[model samples]
Target: MNSLYAMPGNEAFAELLSLHTGYQRRQLLLHHFPDSETLVRMAPPTPGGDAVIVCTLDRPDPKALPLMMAAATARELGAARVGLVAPYLAYMRQDKRFHPGEAISAKIFADWLGHTFDWLVTVDPHLHRYATLAEVYPNAAHVVHVASQLAVWIDAHVTMPLIVGPDQESAQWVTAVSNLLCAPSVVAHKERHGDRDVEILLPEMDKWRDHTPVLVDDIIASGETMVQTLRCLHARTSLPPVCVAVHGVFAEGALEGLLAEGAGLVVTSNSVITDTTQIDISKPVAEAMVSLCEANPTETARRTPA
Candidate 1:
């Protein structure tokens, strides 16, 4: 049996993963102390086959302790193998220390997960400086691309879609996705004044104003860029542009704010579980996990999710 364990926030995604791999759904009894210390309880046994932990690392601080406990406990409980499927991997943005005496969190987070789990599989992490996951993680690591899924979404929904990269960083993803959709793509120039304040300048759009602009990016953390870009799109076009992201790290009201800002569509992959987007990316995640487990089938405990 595949021992699949999931945090409370990840139960829905766990269900999807179980459906994909035909693994039994297991839940971890997660608790929080008054001082916010996390207390994790083993709700299911670590089966002999493979242990798969399905925890998308969004708002990850609180779940860190529980994940550590769960992984360690699974090892002690005789799991045949262990792996993690974190679709929306967090702490990947800060690869370097911009200021002195700051911790290189990306390296720390990578090492922590690398040490805890036998292997790691994620989808479209907010990778900035690092070229690949194997650079930081000593164990097996895999990344699932959702550009194909986003392309499928574009082909089914939008007509005459003009894919727009909100910033230069997003240009690569936008260009790749546009090629997948066989549509024209444009990259907007961005000037960041501060953490929350940003300015977006679009090039001449007289030829493509009628085309439905779809803003694409890897991650939408603060939603500042998307919101600002939405406002810019509203000023230029009569219809609101569709906003799509690989990881919907929509802080607080980012999704609602985008919709209220006259967004025609706001969708994200199943990498991050949210109410707005339901595009499934479980197939790739499952495949990555299966490959990871097959490679390292130690006498370990595997936690199947959901």
Candidate 2:
């Protein structure tokens, strides 16, 4: 008898997840004050059931306090356990302190979330530095990979897709999607001139010139890499390339920018609610949420050593 709660802006995905998990969907009523305080109100949780909060932490700064308050409210309402289903987790880019006096926000954020939720679930958190979520999160945490889902979208939408990675950082997941789709792939080298400027050096892709290029990446924040990649592809083929990604963190006209650069189609997982989110990842996330709610975190911690 797990109860699902949807935070603000996450109701649609939460409802889908509830349908998959067969859990009753609830809502957390939030009242914001002018002084920047929040009051979270939710119905009492079932006596022996887990209270799961579905909040996608994409733009995490404003949502952090409310999420903490919602979890605490659930616990105060006599829930047996509390968990979070954040489809797109943020604050994972800074996994290490690159310079002196820098704050490793990744670990700090993970620790804060670990303290708040008994169990956690997310989709494809930026695991560049930390090998796994377990390294930073202290409780049972699950990562829902969206590579197969990405492949499904690309295979169904694109014709004769030639999977392309924007840069070396994206090679791993891009390769996974390419292999899953059994499409030829190429990785490009990227030189960052500035925050929104990048130079893409693609290998000789004349062999794949005939096939429709499908540029793939995990997070499309600034979208400079994809834009640069599209520019490079312009020389190879006249056909408009398709762009697919897991999270579409379209920062200020990023989507329009890609379309303006000659992307035939842009698609992403529903990890973030945007018009380009054609792929629904709620089922896998629901499965992980159910598993996390059922398993005992203490036993899981014992089995997996520090």
Q: How badly does each model clash, as a count of residue pairs?
A: 16, 0
lDDT string for model 1 (1-306, tens) is: 777788777888888778888788765787778987777777555556667888889999877888888888776777766678899888887789988988999999987887788778998777778888778666777888788888888889899989989899898789889999999888889999987799998877778878999999998888989888888787677667999888988888787888888888898887877776758888888877777767745432223221
Model 2: per-residue lDDT, tens digit, 1-306?
Answer: 889999988999999997787899876899988998999999888877899999988888999889999998898888778889999999998888888999999999988887888888999988887888889887888999989999988888888889999999999888899899899999999998788989999998888778999999998888889999998888898689999999998999898999999999898888999889899999999999988888964554322221
By summed lDDT, the worst window of 10 consecutive residues in model 2 runs over: 297-306
RMSD to truth, every model: 3.6, 2.5
TM values, all candidates: 0.91, 0.95
Highest TM-score among the candidates is held by which one? 2
Which sections of candidate 1 miss by over 4 Å? 32-38, 43-48, 296-306
lDDT scores in order: 0.81, 0.88
